[model samples]
Target: MRLQQVLSLVRKAADDYEMIQDNDKIAVGISGGKDSLTLLHALNGLRRFYPKHFELHAVTVDLGFENLNLEEIKALCESLDVEYSVIHTDIAKIVFEERKESNPCSLCAKMRKGALNDAIKQAGYNKVAYAHHKDDVVETMLLSLIFEGRLHTFNPVTHLDRTGLTVIRPLIYMNEADVIGFVNKHQIPVVKSPCPMDGHTKREYIKNLLKQLNYENPGVKERMFTAIQNGNMKGWPVL
Candidate 1:
């Protein structure tokens, strides 16, 4: 059932945004997390039955995270017979040293994203796929609205034409619960980050705060996801 849900979302995203090509090379961004692992697994499964031919490669960035098991992620990819690559960067050091005035998460994310793009480009892949799901999009929407004074969510599809690359989110239709369930059922090896401030971040706050609202209004996240899909968001600024 988990595989089915994941495949459905991937196919839907591909069809909805024309993300896949006849002979495309896709580099999947993996962070040793549930979402990224599940995405890699699902995409590999989809490749068997997809009408057009496409290659799947897994890319991970080592952000100088403590206790990071680069070998474990490489082993998982090898078990699936997918090519894997890791880029090492001391992002934690940079974040700690340079980011004193602004929020670290935003800057760290920018650097990580840039690293992913560099890996994708260096690997000769034309497109990069991330593991952002429905709940992530909804959370980002609320975070932007409440804090950034805007109504915005990550797009299901994005084209970086200048870089001659495209970014796609295949799990945009699946929720966090589904991903967690899938990961637990499979007992996939997940490498945990050793950030002492993991749960104290603003994103975590919003997640918990939203959970309270969701308790009072069931499917609040689902409703927000629907609004993003059905709303006339074409004219709105897209990131």
Candidate 2:
């Protein structure tokens, strides 16, 4: 996907959810992965022509992994003229070495988000942007259904009253395949995930399951996204 195409989808999600307000400061959570980097590019492009005047900042919570290099990410942010910040923490140690949780994704995510949220709040940003896309939405819904016995996924716009920060998903309308296409086409610097359990998780299982289901029954993913849009879920944009 081209930058224009990416911006179109991002603009639609932003407008539909009223995500960007004039003079609002929004931070994009950069995980150094393709999805977040795509989001950074989309939002940066959107800022050029978006009628609503908002600021974009790129933030990453460094999990204190030795092999995690962020120099390229910093250069990318510089090229895009977006301010970037990295919150250093020993989350990897706490979750893996110290706590030794069997299911470390949950605790690691909690710590990562906590660090990200604190940085956003301290920076005085009102909203933060996440990179959860269409595939993630479907996978999360399936995970909820299969495990928690509920048809639930994240909202495009979420208000974290506790933190006084609203979270927005500008890339919610984007597909993961398109994200890959865009990244590959533009040669975006995507840092490989340094986590030991990058693809070995329940979400990965559901992702494969959903892929198989879509293969057996074509367009199932799109239908699932449509259902989510019309499910009357709180914080979801009313279609």
Candidate 3:
């Protein structure tokens, strides 16, 4: 039942948005975590039967984590038989030493995305896929509404001007729990976040708060997810 739900969501996103195409050389941004790894695995599952003859390659930005090996990511990609690349950036040091941000997740996220966008483009892949799931979209929507005074969420598919890249999120329909379950089932070796302050961030708090709300009112999040799925979001000026 769980697998059916996940595949349903993935297929809906692919069909609804026309994300993949024949002869597409897509770069999957791998962040060495469950979300990204789960995406990689899911895409691998669908690649052969995907309506289009597309290729999946894994790319990770080395943010200078201590004891981190680019080899693990390489091996993971090799095991999957997909091409891989590791672009280095001093993000960890920059966040701690230069920015000195108490809550660095926001800035760190932006920096890492920028780096990945640039790296992927340079590697000659115009289409890049990310592992941002449904929860990430909801959190982004909440963050924008509360902090930016706008109700906006990242689209499942978007074009980044800096890199001239078409960024797609194939896992936008699956939630974090589903991703974790898939990863555990497959025994995927995922790299932990290099951040020292992983769970203390404001987004984590929001995630926990949402979880509690979901517990109190079953289907609260599910209903919200359906709302997004049903709505004509493209008509919005924000997109």
Q: Please name the candidate that would achieve the greatest TM-score relative to the true structure.
A: 2
Best by lDDT: 2
Runs of candidate 1 exceeding 4 Å displacement = 98-102, 235-239
**Which candidate, 1 or 3, has the higher lDDT?**
1
TM-score of 3: 0.90
Q: In candidate 3, which residue pairs clash?
A: none
Q: lDDT of all predictions, in order shown? A: 0.84, 0.95, 0.79
Total clashing residue pairs per candidate? 0, 0, 0
Candidate 1, residue 3: the lDDT equals: 83
Model 2 local distance difference test score: 0.95
Residue 63 of model 3, lDDT score: 80
How high is the lDDT of residue 126 in model 1? 90
Residue-by-residue lDDT tens digits, candidate 2, 167-190: 999998999999999999999999
Error of 2 at 8 (Å): 0.5
Question: Per-residue lDDT tens digits of candidate 1, residues 39-152?
Answer: 999899889998878999999888887788877888889999999988899888888766652578777888898988987897789989999988788888889999999988
Give me the runs in candidate 2 sitting further than 4 Å from their true place: none
